[model samples]
Target: MNAWKMPVAWMSMVALLVGGCNKDEQNVAPTDDNEAITTATLTLVNKAVPTDTVRATIENLNTTADFSKATLNLKANTTYTGTIGLLDKTKTPVVDATEEIREKVNEHLFVYTYSATSGSQNALIVTITDKDTNPAPGPYPVGLSTDMQTGAAGTGTLNVVLRHQPNVKDGTPNPGSSDLDTSFPVVIQ
Candidate 1:
C-alpha cells in the first residue's frame, strides 16, 4: 500500500507541473492589420445590480431605477440621458416619466450633462460620480467617464468599476447589508 501511494503521489505531482505550464498567456497583441481602427464611433453600455436580487421593502420607484442604457459617446464626447419610462402594458409614462427627471430619472439611455472645461485638463474625459446635490432631488444619474476618466486621459477605452451606495438601514433584501456602499459595474462607449 505504501509503495503504491508513493507512485500515485509522484504521478499527481508530474501532472500538476505539466498542467501549470499550459496556463494561458496574458495581454496578447494583434498579429495583423486585420484589426483596423474602427472608424464608426461606437458606444458600449452596461449596468448591473450589486446584489443578486433586490429587497421587497424597496419602493417601486427605487426598484425601477436602472443604469442599463446610460451611455457616453467616445467619439462625439457627449452624454445623453436615459430612462425606463413606464406605461401600463401600453408603454406610456405611468406618472409623468415623460417629462425629464432631475436626479429622479428612470430611463437608462445615456450619460449626464457635464460642464465642459477648457484648460490643460484632460479634455476627452468621461465622469461617473455621485452626490446628494442635483437641480431636484431623487436618484440623480452619475457620470462614469466624465472629468479625465473618459477616453481623453489616454486610451479612450476605460473599463468601469462599480462600488455600491450605502443605504443599509432602510431594509432591502440582500445577503450583504444594503447601502449607498453597495454598487455594481457600468460602462460607456
Candidate 2:
C-alpha cells in the first residue's frame, strides 16, 4: 500500500507541474483577414474654394485591371482637404470597407508616399489630420482623411497604402502587411 501511494503522489506532482507550465494564452493577438478592397477613391476638395474638387480612383478588383492607373490633377502650391474611401464591389450593395477600417482603426494604418516623375521622393506633403484611439491603450492616426498640399508645378506619383497591423502599429509604415496599395498620377499644374 505504501509503494502504491508514493508512486501515485509522484505522478500527481508531475501532472501538476506540467499543467501549470502549459501556455493557454498566446502573446500575440489572433490575425483577422483583410477586407477585399475592389476600389479606392480619393476625393480632394479645394480648401479655399469648396466647390472645386478632384477625384482619383482605382477600380477593377475582380480582374487583371486591379492595378489600373488613376490621375489626380491639382493646382501647384495648393492645399486640399482629402477623404479616402474603400469599397468591396463583390457584394450586392458595395461593402463600405472604410467603415470596417474605422472599426479596427487601431489595427490598421494608411501610408501615403509621394515621388516626382523625375524620381524625387516626398514631392507632396500629406498629413493625416484625424486620429483614432486603439483598444490596446494608445492613439494613432488612421489615414481615411487627410490634408494634402502640392509642393510645386510638377508631375509625380502619390502612393496610398493601407496596412493591416494587428498588434504592432506604431505610427510609421514599418510593421504590417499592405491591405491596399495604389498609385495615382499626380499633376500639380
Candidate 3:
C-alpha cells in the first residue's frame, strides 16, 4: 500500500508540471505582421525656400519596382523638411499605409542609411523629426517626418528601412523585422 501511494504521488507531480508548461505557452502573446507597402514617397521642401521642393516616389515595391522617380535632386549645403508617405496599391481604392503606421506609431521605426557613391565626398544626412507617444524614458522616433540636410555637391545611395517593432521598440532598428528596405539615388547639386 505504501509503494502504491508513492507511485501515484509522483505521477500527479509530473502531470502538474506538464500542465503548467502548457498554460505558459497559451499565455504568450502573438506578434504583429509586417505591413504591405507597395509605394513609398519622400517629399522634401526647402526650409529656407519652401518653393524649392524635391519629391521622389518608388512604386511597385512588392513586385517589379519602378524607380524612375526615386532620384532625389537636392541642393547642396541646404536643409529640407521631409515627409514620407506609404501606400498599399494592391487595395482597390489604394490604402494609405502611412496612416496605419501613424495609428500604431509606437510599433514602427524608419531607419535611414547612406552610402556615398564612388568618388563622391558627401552623403545625405537624415534626422527623424517625429516621435512616438510612448511614456517616460520612451517617446521614440517614428521617422515619418524628418529634417534632411545636404552636405555638399555629391552623389550617394540612401537606404530607407522600416522596422516593425511591436511592443519592443527601444529607439533602435535592431529590435524588429524589417517591413520595407529600399534605396534611392541621391544627387545633391
Candidate 4:
C-alpha cells in the first residue's frame, strides 16, 4: 500500500468508526427536557441568631433601614452561613456578611459552590423580603441599597468551577478551597 494512502485510509476508518458514537453528557440550559440547567445545592449551617434585634445589637446598629439602604434579595426559604458581604462606594467590602444567608430583596450573599459543568452556567436569582412585618425602605438593591458596581441584585451569573467534594480526580487528592470567589455578575433588575 502507498504510505500516504495507507495513513489516509486509517484516518478515514477512525472517523467513520467514531463519528457514530453518541456520548450523552450534561447539557445545561433553560429547557423543558428537565436536564437542561445544571445546578448544585448546598445547605450551610447558620451561626447567627435569627432575631433582628440580636443581629442589630451585635452589629451595634438598629435593624432599621434608617438612612442606610436596606439590604434585599435575601431568600428566607433557604438558610445560608458565613459573612455575606457588601462593597462600599470605593468598591471595598464594607459590611461583612455575618448571617448564614439572609432572606430579603436586594441583598448580596455568598454561594458555597454550584455544580456547573464546564461551558454551562446558571443565572443566580436572589430574593430578599421583609423578614419582619415592617419591611425596610425602597430604592434597595437594583435601585435601593447597592448600585451596579456593588452587585447585581436578585440575579447573577454562577459558572461551574469544578466538581463537588474531595476535589480529586482519578483517585488523586484535589487541591485547595480557593475557588470560593468563583462567581460572575448579573444586571440590576
- Summed backbone clashes in each candidate are 41, 0, 0, 28
lDDT of 1 by residue, 1-189 (tens): 699899999999999999888776576886431111111112233223222211111123234534343333332343322222221222332333223222322222223223333222343444434333334343444332223333332222222222223332111122222112112222223
Write the residue-wise lDDT of candidate 4 on 36-150 in tens digits. 1111222223224343210111121222223122212233233334123322222143322222113322232222222323222332223332222223442322111110111
Q: Candidate 1, TM-score vs. the true structure?
A: 0.20
Candidate 1 displacement at residue 111 in angstroms? 12
Task: Give a tens-digit lDDT track for model 3, residues 1-189.
Answer: 699999999999999999998885755586439999999999999999999989999999999999999999988889999999999999899989999999999999999888888435445788999999988778999999999988878888889999999989999999989999999899887
List ranges where model 4 is wrong by over 4 Å.
1-4, 22-53, 56-175, 178-189
Candidate 3 wrongly placed segments (more than 4 Å): 1-32, 118-122
Candidate topping lDDT: 3
What TM-score fits each model? Answer: 0.20, 0.77, 0.81, 0.20
User: CA lDDT of 118 in candidate 1?
Assistant: 29
lDDT of 2 by residue, 131-171 (tens): 87865455888998999987668888888999999889888
Instruction: Report every candidate's CA lDDT.
Output: 0.30, 0.84, 0.91, 0.27
User: How should the candidates be ordered by TM-score, best one leading?
Assistant: 3, 2, 1, 4
Models sorted by lDDT, best on top: 3, 2, 1, 4
